[model samples]
Target: MKDADFSDLLLIRKGEKDLTLGGGDSALAPVVSIGEWEARKEALKELYMLTLGQAPYHDIDPDLEIISEEDCGAYLRRKLMYNTGADERISAYMLLPKGLKGKVPAVLCIHPTTSMGKEQTIGNDPSSNGHDRAYALHLVEQGFITFAFDLMSAGERCFSGLKDFDTAPFYEKYPKWSSRGKDLWDVSQALDVVQSMPEVDAEKIGSIGHSQGGGITIHAMAVEPRIKAGVSSCGEWPMRISKNPFNAARTGWWVGRPLLRPFCVTGKEFPVQMHELLAMAAPNAIMNISALNDCKYTVEEKEFTGEAFRNMEENARKIYQLYGRPEAFKSITHLNGHSFLKEQRKAAYEFLKQHLFK
Candidate 1:
């Protein structure tokens, strides 16, 4: 269907006047007090859920099944699968640190936009160069039980013979549900699996991701309260400020949400923006890692410079401060271009450790 043919129904239930673009200087309605923020948090989550489409039923039990186990020196890696819905099951790797004396902190490791999926997070992908992308392995070595899983369109979950993300089958099966919704649900279920484990401290769970995984990290933390702390590396930017906000490769067709097409075509302001989404994670520890040169011209020439990251951070910080937990929200920027290297990985790990362990 052409972009213009998509429905123009308002994605958010609240009127546009009540919403703000975030940041100190935005023209939209700014959240001023903690009471105001408390009333708006649920609405903002509902608005984001509207953009993502219908969520899957969560009442079904995750029938956990173990497929295999391997000894990896510092940790034991177990390949497993569990039900996220009545019919849907997702593959994951659960890394448990050896010689555990008691229940330990756990982290959900999310991979970037690679076909390697959970494999890259565990250092099993040769194409990942080194241990930089193997953050799950790194975390396990640091004594945190780590769970890494394949997103719907990546790794083992990708369609056979497809090297890149394929959303056709997903849309065909769940015509009304968006891929983003499925992802968010899967993440929440993954947390359920982690909390069920006897070796894990249920209350100490956190999440970390890079690129696409990073964006999912923010979304998951906003809606999934089980995620006590989160680290997102170069994962997001304000959609309204993006050059091609609704292009296919950006947040348009890939997200499987056609409702955004009307706004893109008419150049209308989005009722919901990324900064508002970030604010929804208030009181919970969240660290945003951005790169100054993370630019891309695939759909349209646009650069996610450090300046843009700071603007979004500044806006989200206002909400965290209102909660009296200003230090819970942290951000860092590097000169690297669209990449998460060793230095950034160390900082992310340190942040997660401080919040989850200390």
Candidate 2:
């Protein structure tokens, strides 16, 4: 679709019901009935794809390659690489539980914004400090086949002598595409890798992440129906409320896109809101784990406060209620500031298990 066509969908219309009511103040489109929601869902998906730059077709075979393998007692850990694009490969680590009786549920464990990338999720990088970030390892011990991979510009994908979070090289390679798109595309590809495994129950795949990874989990769950359930930790924030919505200047590129840059510069409202994005995953199981003190510094400034996060969850719950599966949508908050503590990790695993395992 043309940039103008996509931008037009984002324009707020008159005479629509307001879902945000007293929530974090933002212009959101009204939620319609189930039949209308089905059509609107597809439209919203298209708009999001346009905003992130449509991902190229992945027609090539994912020629999977195993670099090395080691036995870690309860599970076998393998360092592997697979094709995302015909010319592009993603480095990953897969933990397969030993002596599986049959096909079991699998989880795509996305790591936070650390230089260690997938290594942190598997507890292989001690220098990357955090509490129980080795969630991939923990899940594997719980008998779930877990796959963790390096996002673009992270882990082994990082350029020589550069940090993992750098996006300059990525933009240089694909100036029109946003880092967010690449991340989400890679995740869909990772799902391909995990689903192909003999020990994995392809129908029971889920995703979990914290911070940047958390944000990716949310987007991935929205677009990829293969993700039966997901846990997004401390990644709830409205793009319009961002100081530089849609990364207008291309600095700190996360959710910014070229098509939305004009709106950012003009200070105009985007057609969709964060709550609406979360709502797009209705009838499917998804949980938002927000920290009460998340973005503490900014909350002190009255920007993206915890109240806003709860408001987004509340508004999104309306869609779940419409689907008659309100229990499938859940959220929990803690006093910890931005960090995913051990207790939160436990809760996340339980939620995923409840949804994906049974």
Clashing pairs in 1: 23-315
**Candidate 2's residue-wise lDDT over 95-207, tens digit each?**
99999999999999999888888889998866635446888998999989999998887888886676667787767777777778888878888988888888889999989
Best by lDDT: 1
Alpha-carbon lDDT of model 2: 0.76
Q: Which candidate tops TM-score?
A: 1
Per-candidate alpha-carbon RMSD to the true structure:
6.6, 6.9
TM-score of 1: 0.86
Give the poorly placed runs of model 1, Cα more than 4 Å off.
1-30, 128-130, 247-253, 297-304
- For model 2, the stretches where C-alpha displacement exceeds 4 angstroms are 1-32, 240-249, 252-256, 296-304
Error of 2 at 175 (Å): 1.8
What does the lDDT read for residue 356 in candidate 2? 90
- Candidate 1, 72-136: lDDT as tens digits: 88889998889987787888999999999999999999998888889999998777454677889
